[model samples]
Target: MSRATRRGGTGRSLRTTFSIARPHLRGHGLLIAGGMATLLVEVVLRVLEPWPIKVVVDAVSVSLGADSGATAGLPAATVPLLLACGVLLLGLVGLRAIAQYCSTIAFALVGSRVATALRARVFAHLQSLGLGYHSHAKAGDTVQRVIGDIGRLQEVAVTAGLPLVGNIVTLVVLSVVMLVLDPLLAVVVLLAAGAYLLLSRRGAPRITAAARSTRRSEGDLANTAAETLGAIRVVQAYGLEGQRAEAFDRGNARALSQGVKSRRLAAALERSTDVIVGLALAVVLVAGGWRVIDGAMTPGDLVIFTMYLKIALRPLKDLAKYTGRIARATASGERVAELLEERVDIADRPGTPPLGPVSGDIRFDAVTVDDGHGRRLFDELTLDIAAGETVCLLGPSGAGKSTLAGLLTRTSDPFSGAVRIDGVDVRDATVSSVRGSVTVVLQESVLFAASVRDNIRAGRPDASDADVERAARRALAHDFVTALPRGYDTVLGGRGDTLSGGQRQRIAIARALLRDAPIVVLDEATTGLDPAARAAVAASIAELTRGRTTLSVTHDATSVRDADRIVWLEDGRIVEDGTPRSLLADPGSRVAAWFRESLQEAS
Candidate 1:
C-alpha cells in the first residue's frame, strides 16, 4: 500500500492521535497531571455522595418504625442524625464542585497551549514546503487543515479526552461498588452497558464516514470562498458574483446534508442508550422491592443499589454521545497528519555548510532540467557570468529564463546538473545561505499589508529607518513616499493595492537594493509599466544593478539596450550571445527580428 493510504487510514489510531498531542502534553505535564488528579478525586467523591441520602433514609425509617436491635444503641432523636447527614452531603457536593472547576480550568489551559503550539508548527511547516507542493495545493484547503482541523484536535484534548477518560474511571469504580453490594443487580447493569457498547460500535463506521465527508465538504467550501475573495476584483469586473455564490451554496448544502446524517446517527445512539439504562433501572427497582418486602434487604439498601446502577450506566450514555465528537476529531486528525507528512523536497542536505560572501561569479555546469511535467527545458546547458557583469536574457515566452533564476535562488533544483555561485555548488551549501546571496524583483511586486517602511525593511529586517529612506531615495520612491499620509509609516493595503503599479515596482526595487546581495534578478520587472513608471523603475534598476552581478529577463528594447550583453535563447539553447547593438544591427538575425517585433508592440 502507498504511504498516504497507510497514513490516512491506520495513522488515525488512538495511539497515533495521542502521539500527535504528546509533545504539548509533555510540555505542560504538571497541568495535565493536576487535571487528571482532580478528576479522579471528583469521581471518588461522587461515588460517596449518595451514601448521605441513604443514611438519612435509614435513620427516618428507624424513627418511624419500632426501635429494632439495629437502632438499639443509636440516638433516640433522628433529627440530629438527619442534620449530620445533610451537612456531610453539602460538604461532599461543594468539594466535588471545586474539583470540577479546577479540572476544567487545568484541562482548558493545556488544550489552549497545545493548540497554539500546533498552529505555529503547522504554519512554519507550510512555509518550509517547496513551491512545487504549493502550486498544486489549494489555499483554502490548506487554511482549513491548519485552522479548522487543528481547532478540532484542541476540542478533542479538552472535551473528548478528559471526559471520556473521567467517565470510564467513574463507571469502573461505581461498577466495582455495585458488584460488592449486590452482584445480581450489578450483573444486569453490566449486561445493559455491554449491549450499549455493541450498538455504539455497530453505528461507528457510518458516523465516521459521514463526519469525514462533512469535514471535506467544509474544506471545499472554505476553498471556494477564499479563492473568490482573493480574486474579488476579477470576479466583480467579469460579473461572476452570482456564479461564485452558486458554487459556495452547493458546497454548503452538501456539508449541511452530511452534518445532519452524522448528527442523526449520534442522536440515535444516545436515545438507544437512554432506553437501555431506563429498563435496567426498572428491573433493579422491581427486584429490590421484592427483596425489601421479604425482609431480605433494607429500603435504604435498595436505594443505594439503584443509585450505583445509575452511576455505572451514565458513562454508557456519555459514550454514545461522545462517539460523534471522537469521529469528527479523528477525521480532522487524519487531514492534519497528511499535511504534516509532506516531505520538504528542496531542503538543504544534512551537514551542509553555510555559504560565505560571494564575489558574484555564477555558472551552470552541464545542467539538465525538466518543467516537472516531463517536458525538457534544458539539456546539458552551460552558461557563465563574470563578477559585476550584467547579462540580459532575451527569449520568447516559455523559453526558461525564469527557470534559470529559480535554480540560482534554490527555489527548485536542476534535474541532473549543478548550479554554482562563486565556484561552490548550491546543493552543497545551506539553502538559506544560497538564497541569502541573491535578491529578486519579479514582474509583479509582492508586498504584505504593512507600513511602507516595513515592506522595504523586509529585505533586511535589521535596517534602520535612515537606511530604508536611503534605499527608497536611490529607487526614486522617497518623494512619493514622503507625500503619503503617514510618510514612511503609511500602511498599505493587501498586496499594496493602494499604490499605483509603478509606485509598487519602485518600492520593490528599493527593497532589493536594501538587501545589498552580490547577485540580483530582475524578471520582466519593467514589462507592464506606463512610460513614466517604466522610466522611474528603469532608472532605479540602473542604480541597483551597478557593481552587482545582475540577470535581466525581459523583452523590452530599452532594458536590452542597457545590458552589457544579451543572451538570446531559443529551443533551450543560446542561439545568439553578443552586445545588444551588434545583435540589433544584424538584419538577417532572429534576435534583430525579435527586438523589432517587441519595439513595434510597444509603439
Candidate 2:
C-alpha cells in the first residue's frame, strides 16, 4: 500500500479491476467492436492523407530540375495535377473527421451504459453486505466510491481510455507504414518511440502512487465531513466547532497536497516527452537530408518521412498524458473492486427454503455467540418462549440484551447453535422470509424522507392506506399525522427528525402494527421519552403485542412489570429467570434491587 516496494502491484491491481468490469461490459461487445473499426478507418485515412502532398512535392521538384535523379515516377506538375492533390487531401480529412466522430459517440454510449450498470451493482452489493461489515464502515467513504469514482471511470472512458486505445493502435499502424516506406529512417522513428515508452515506464509507479494517495486522502476527508455533519448536534452542544474544523482542515490539506503532487508528476512526464520528440525530429531531418542530397531518396520522400514522424509524434506525446489519466482511473477502479468483492457472511444457506406460517414459538437452542472480539456472549445457553408469551430481558450495558435481539433477527449469526421460529432454524430458511415473520421497534426509529403513509407502509408494502391510518391511530400517531400540512400525505424530514421523539416512536410503533407479524421485539423502545410520551408509546406497544410472542430487551426496571417472565442477564449469562411477581417477592433478587434503583432515580 506504500509508494514503493513493487512494480507488479500496479499491473495486478489493473488486471483485477478489469476482471471486475468484465461482467458489466457484457452485451456491449458489438458496439465496442464497431468503435474500434472506426478507429482503424481513421488511422488508414491519416496515413493516406500525406500521400497526395508527397505527389505534389515530387512533381514540383522535377519541374524545377532539382531531382531528375530521385523523382523517377513523379507526376507531371500541371494545373490538373495540383487540383487533384488538393481535392484528395480535402477528401481524406473529411473522411477521417467522420470516422473520429462515429468512434467517439460509440465509445461514449458504451461508457455510460457500463458505468451505470456498475454503480447499480456496487450499490446493491453494499446494501446486501452484513451488518457486521456496515458497523465498521464509513458511509461517506463508501458513497464516494459508488458515485464519484465510478463517474470518473465513465468520463475517462471517453476522454482518456477510448482515445488512448485508439492512439495506441494508430501508433502501431503508423510505425508499420514508416518501415515499409524506408527501413533505415523507420529505425529513428521506432527508437524515439521506445525511449518515450521507457521514460513513461520509469515514471508510472510514482504517478500511480500519487494517484492512490490522493484518492485515499479524499476519502478520509469525506469521512471526516460526514462524521462531523452527522454529529453536528453534539458538536454545537459541546461547543467543539473549532476542533471539528481543525480535523477537517488537516484532511483537506493532505488531499490537496497529494492531488498537486500527482498533477505535477504527470506534467513533468509530458514535458520530458516533448524534448524526446524534438530530438527524434532533428535526427530524422538530418538523415533524410543526406539521402536526398545523395539522390538515394527524393525530396518528396524526405517530406513524407518528416510528415509521418510528426503524425506519429501526436500519439507518442498523448500516450504520456493518457497514462497518467489511466493511473488515476485505475486507483478508483481498485477501490470499487474492493467494495464489490466484499464477502457476504449473513446471507441464507444455499437451497434454504422460505419460512412457513409461524405460531411464534421462539427458541435459542444451546446457542454459543461471540461479540466479534473473541468475547463469549452466550456459551451453551438454551432458552425457549412458547406461543404468544411475553418474555422481557433485563441487562446492563454490554450484557448482550440488544445482542440477543440481534440473534433472533439474524443481524449476526451465532458462533454455534440455532435460533428457531417454531421448529424451523432461522439460518435453515431464506433470510428475507425469516425476518419477515418478525417486527422490531428500536430505541431510535429510523424513517425515510417520504410521505407518512409510505413510511408506515414500509413494514408491509401491500398494506392499504386505510390499514396504515388504522395502525397509526392504534399507535397514538394518527392525531399528529392528521395535524401536519398534508395529513398522512405529508412528507417527513430525514430520519423523521421533523417530529418529536414521542411522535417518531408512535410512527415506528404504527409501522410495527401494520406489519402484524407473529413475533415482536422492543429494544428499549420507550427509553428516551418523557413520562407522557412513555405512557402513550407503552399503550401502543401493549396493543401491538396483544397476541404475539414478544421479547422486550430493556434497561428500564419499570418496563418489565407487564411481562409474563423476566430474565436478568450479566456478563453473557442469565443470573435470574422467573415470573416478575416472584422476583419482586424476593427483596435480595437483582430485579427487586433494580426496581428499587429505578424508583429512587425517579424520586
Candidate 3:
C-alpha cells in the first residue's frame, strides 16, 4: 500500500515471486515458445480480419449509387463479391479461434506444472526451517501461504495473464497498421491508451491496498478456525462456543469488506476506460466523415480506420479487468515468497561426513546455551557418560535438563561449546545423521492416524514387518495391538487419541526399540499415566533402553530408582551426582529433599 501504488513498485512483487519460482519453470521452454508462436499467428490473423469487412462495406456503397469503387477484375455480380468477402471473414475468424485455443492450453499447462513444483518445494522448505521459527509460526497462516496463496498465482496466470499477453500484442500491431492507413485517426488510439494509463495510475493504489488487506484478514480467519478446531475439546469443556463464533464472524466480515472494496475499485477503473474509449470513437467518427466527403479518404479506408480503432481500444478493457486480478495475486505471491526465504536453522557444514556408527560414549564439553533472552542455561558446564550407562537427570523446571537431549539430536546447536557423540562433534556431521543415531520418546508421543504396524515401522523405514512385531512384543504392546478390531492394520484417530495413554506409550517404545540407536532418551515419558499404566510402561522402558546409553529425565522417584547414576541440576549446574542409593542415603541430600517436597505437594 505504501509504495506499491507507484509505477515501478507495483510490479516489483510480481517480478520477485516469479523469479523465486523460475527454477520450477524450467524444462517447459518448448511449450512456452510454442504458445508465443501460436499467439503470433493469431495477431496476424486479426490484422487481416478488418480487410474483409472493409471490402463488404465498399461493395455495398458502390451498389447504392455511390462512387464507382475499385471492383477487381470481372466480379460483375455484387452477390458474388459479398459472398466471397463473407467466406474470407469466416475463414480468418475460424483460424484465429484455433490459435487461441492452442495458445491457452499451452500456457495453462506451464502454469499448472510450475505451481505444483513450487508448492512442493515450499512445503519441504517449511519443514527444514528451525524449531525456533516454527515455535512462533501459526499453523493456519502457514497453511494459507503454502496452499491458498500459491493457488492464486496459478489461477491468475491462466485466466488473466495469458489473455493479457495476446491482447497487448494485438494492440501494438493494430496501432501500427492504423498509422499507415491514416496518421491522424491513429492519434485517437494513442490518446485513448494514455488516458487509460492515467486512470490506472490514479486508481491502482486503492486496489492494491484493498487486496493486501483482504489477504491478511483471510490469514487471520484461517488461523482462528485452525486454533479453535485444534482445541475443540477444551473449548467445549469451557462452554465457549459463542465466543469462538463471534471471533470467526469478526474475521469473516473484515475480509468481506476489503474484498468488496477491491472489486469496486477495479470496476470503476474498467467503466472509466469505457468512457475514455467512447469519446475517442466519437471524435474519429466526426473527423473521418468529413475527410471521406472531401475525397481525401475513401469510404473503405474510413471503415478500416474505425475497425482498427475498436481493435486497438480492446486492450484497454483487458488491462482494466486483469489489473485487479493481478494485484490480488501479487499480494498472495509475496506471502509465499516471504516464507520460502526463511533460513534453514540446522544443516550440515561444508565437507562434513554423515554420522556413521558410534560407541555410546557422550560428552558435553564446556557447553553453553543461551535461551535467546540473555540468560544462559549452561555456561561452560561439562558432563560425560561412559558407554552403555544409564543416567537420570532430575531438576525443577527450566534447569536445562531437556536442553541436553535437544543438543544430542541437533535440534539446536549449543551457543558456545560442543556436544560430542564419542569423539565427533554433533555440529560437524549432517543433521539427519546426528538425529538418526539417537532415539527419543517424549512425554507427548506424537503418532499419525495409521495402522499400528505403520506407526511402529516409522522409526526405521526399512524395518521389516517381522522386525516391527518383534519390537512390539519386547515393548509389551503386541497383545493389545492384536486385540484391536483389525489387529495391527486397525487405523487410529488423529494423534492416536483412540488408544489409552499406556497403549500409546508402549507403541512409541516399540518404535524406539525398532530404531535401535546407540543412545536413547526418555523425557518425562510416563508423567500423565495412571499408577497401573505407569508401572506397565515402566517395564517396557527397561527393555527399550537396555545396553544403550540411556537418559531418563523425570521427577518420578519410581521411574529413576534403578538408574546407575542420578544428576540433580539447579541454576544451570549439576548440584548432586551419585547413584540413587548413595544420594538417598544422605538425609540432607538435594535429591532426597526434592523427593520430600514432591510428596508434600502431592498430598
Q: Estimate, for each residue in 25-60, the C-alpha lDDT of model 3 and write its tens digit.
A: 789999999999999999999899998878877667
Q: Which runs of model 1 end up more than 4 angstroms from their true locations?
A: 1-13, 66-77
Question: Could you give candidate 1's per-residue lDDT for residues 1-603 as a string of tens digits?
Answer: 223225443224444556666776666988889999999999999999999887776666666772453333333336677788889999999999999899989999988898898888888889888878899888998999899988998987688777788889999998889888888878998899889878976887677777878888899999999999989999999999999999999999999999999999989998999999999999999998887676656667788888888887879888888888887887777677678778887887889999998999999998888888999888988899998999999888898999987899988889988999999999999989998999999999999899999999999999999999999999999999999999999999999999999999999999999999999999999988889999999999999999999998986787788788899877888888998789889988877998888789878
How many clashing residue pairs are found in candidate 3?
A: 0
Which pairs clash (backbone N, Cα, C closer than 3 Å) in model 2? none
Ranking by TM-score: 2, 1, 3
Off by over 4 Å in 3: 1-8, 68-77, 600-603
TM for candidate 1 is 0.95
Please, what is the whole-model Cα lDDT of each candidate in the order they appear? 0.86, 0.88, 0.87
Clashes of each: 0, 0, 0
TM-score of each: 0.95, 0.96, 0.94
What CA root-mean-square deviation does each model show from the true structure?
A: 2.2, 2.2, 2.6
Q: After superposition, how far is residue 331 of candidate 1 from its true place, in Å?
A: 1.2
